[model samples]
Target: MISWDKDFKIYNFKSKYGPWALVAGASEGLGAAYAEALAKRGLDLILIARRQEKLDELSKKLINEYSIAIKCLALDLSDIAHVIEVLSQIDLPIGLLIYNAAYAPIGDFDTIPSDDLAKVVDVNIKAPLLLAKFVSKKMIENKRGGIVLMSSLAGSQGSPKLVTYAASKAFNAILAEGLWSELKEHGVDVIASIAGAIVTPGYQQAQNAKKAPGTLTPDQVAEKTLKALGKKPTIIPGFTNKLARFFMGRLIPRKWAISIMKQNTESLS
Candidate 1:
């Protein structure tokens, strides 16, 4: 396990949230952490995940602990058409919408099939963008709300073994920035977060198999993300990851920068 110092600017929310917050991928990982943090801020929740049982269990804990309203939506985001269908069913005035679900497969292009590529694009790129489009309209009509998209550090540069994953994140990063520019004037905030490696179940399993790095914890990432929502359109969630972005931004040559990324990915296995 790798341990590093974390920097946090924990701001207290002075006013309680009105209506509800919808969190996709709320059954586990950083998404679950965000759900808990928002609940603590007095926002009622609408939790979405593929696992109904897990969503129900988490909803119970949030309601029992925070005494806030909790709603659960079990969704498989892979079905693009059904996402819109699912959201139309919710009647609550959603004050916050967070699209946090994602999937990734690690390997070279030849080894990773076209079907896998489409799946990643569907979840990491298409789903979040569609969700943003739908929710932005709702927030627009309401005239006040916040929407956050979960992006990743892989987005900042090319990821060789995870080529499509990096491209999908880049799409999200740009989409969030563009939306933030457009929506802020309308009294709605659109924020995208680039999360670093975190101590979630997926990361833990990757660690056990010597695959992914053990970086920041989910709570640690969540704390930074919450602080960044209103102030900036885009945020990188850990100290090292922030520094990485800063240096990556300064790279003069795109070819050289992507070359470094390719080397890093080759070293992973």
Candidate 2:
């Protein structure tokens, strides 16, 4: 993993008129890094996460460093009614939307509870679908916007251990690709970003004793993801991950692919 550097931007995206961006799961990880990057580019922000304290802390830090306007929303996306209320309330002309919140239950499918699976589905799949519909309607009326749906490399294959999570992410990956084809002609850039394992609070909390040699950092993922925004509709954040995806896509049989994913995720956790 590369060290985080404050001065690593290839090109800045300073908005001329304080256009806005919305980042879900903005308290930490790739979401937090994306928030900072957009703030540096002078985009006003609407940050959403389940934790109020983390949101406030991040809001203060961003405002102090970037001097941009910020609004914080503390809501669980799994709570469908609350999510609907929150989206309906956001009045800003959002130029970009980053759907970055997700969760996964770690275990064999039979052992995992239905409630746990449902929660992962709700955030990983439902929230993005609803948020995208809301944002796209507004952007369509205004004639421009962009969206980046956060997916996972595991989504490309099935996993016996993380069954629901993998399926949900797979849904997200394809959903964004379909949206890109539909929205690009409408002056909207819709992208799906398949992120590799990154060093984040959540990852650290769940990390195995034997950590991998080439895990990426959240900032590194964010940097590449931002650069890939309008140019590529489907982006795999790391060179290693991209190459792995390509090689695996060609050589692995479907049943073996699923077994490998299950073994790796369970062993690595």
Candidate 3:
């Protein structure tokens, strides 16, 4: 079991998030960024994703670069039961859980198929919810650990084209808030990273226009998120994101906020 200093300062990374860390959706993009960041901190990794080849490729690179032990699980997060079963079989001391996988189906909500909608719920909401439930038990037992759930600023309001996705992300933000309150006394740190537009390959493929305001690199978001983990319940990764959240979530009225979000998302979806 790791000890918390009570003063809430993160004196060491491995003490809290190692000797092992697990990154879901870790094949690329933000997930891969988190994996690299944690590996630099001397944490052996258990990386999860649906593509075995990609996982193995990333695993090889990280092992060569960082010389840290790595375990790759090519399991789909949508299969929550199987994901949990595989994780449970791992004997490593995985004290850090980074849930970054999301299924985003963009378009008019009515135009999207029902199966895709269900997938959105399964991947974005169900997986993390269950993973948190499964992992937090061990964290509380050990009396120290961390959970970083990836949310989005788009979740701050009713984003028209991103309706279901936004709702699911909102769920993550609220879930982390509640978990932070409940787990802090147990020495478990929980944080929600409410990120903005990221300059990721996937985002680039989906983006039809110029870069959005407050667009951030995957590394920037990952680094800022890790830095904020033990200190706050939630963090908006960019200055623009923080300001946007302040205005949309607090200053502006709900209808106006929703309209702004609609305008922003309509073009992309």
Candidate 4:
């Protein structure tokens, strides 16, 4: 177990890396929480999301309150070419990258449209892969940086209703673990933030329900995630989530885990 220092200053992210951090999916939910947390830590930001209005409002709020440079990029993650073009034009060196955008299509795998599944792959897998590849190069040169990929508990099991989404998150988790091993030598930190049910707008919309008993707030997850950077290859946000992942991934049989997941997600059917 990694011992976390209670007084560790998260603002040290600027000292270890650089001045700027780029956050994908920064319009709302955990993305917006990350933006707020990072801003509080004194880092300039480049926020990207599909909604221009939301991004603009967030950027203004951060800029006014924190007195830090904020750039809002409203673009679809599925548009690889446009994303690449916009990122390529940025003059600042981005030392921290948070790939938080994801596509979760609920319901049976066969019932969901093929195009929707493909979009999930593109956003959750391809976008992160490309962004990491692009950012790691600059990080390797500087010999200091951090990357956080948003993963899910579903990723570790065969979630029936969220099959494609689970698979994509698994890919992200593995990628982060491998990169953490490989990049540590170069003074770069890679983390897979394995999150459970969080009280976010997206989650509420997707589940069509209010926050459950054990669900975490976005701020809570964001704070914990930032604190865990450079400390572990993977960090499960809440203690309850951590325990659940441990039991589901280790103690329980794989078939049993899948059965439990299927039952839990039956509402999505």
Score each candidate by Cα lDDT: 0.78, 0.81, 0.91, 0.89
Top lDDT prediction, candidate number: 3
Q: TM-scores for all candidates? A: 0.87, 0.91, 0.94, 0.94
lDDT of 2 by residue, 179-225 (tens): 99898878778889997678888767765724554579888888788
TM-score: the better of candidates 1 and 3 = 3
Q: Which ranking of candidates, highest lDDT first?
A: 3, 4, 2, 1
TM-score of 1: 0.87
lDDT of 1 by residue, 160-213 (tens): 888888888889889999989998887788788987677777655542334344
- Evaluated against the true structure, the overall lDDT of model 1 is 0.78
Report the CA-based lDDT of candidate 4 relative to the real structure. Answer: 0.89
Residue-level lDDT tens digits of model 3 in 40-141: 888899999999999999899999998999999999999999999988887677799999999888899889999999999999999999999998898999
Name the candidate, 1 or 2, with the larger TM-score value.
2
lDDT of 4 by residue, 3-112 (tens): 35422454466787658899999999999999999998889999999999999999999999989899898899998678978989976789999999999989888799
Name the runs in model 3 displaced over 4 angstroms: 1-11, 207-209
Q: List the residue pairs that clash in candidate 4.
A: none
Q: What is the alpha-carbon lDDT of model 2 when measured against the actual structure?
A: 0.81
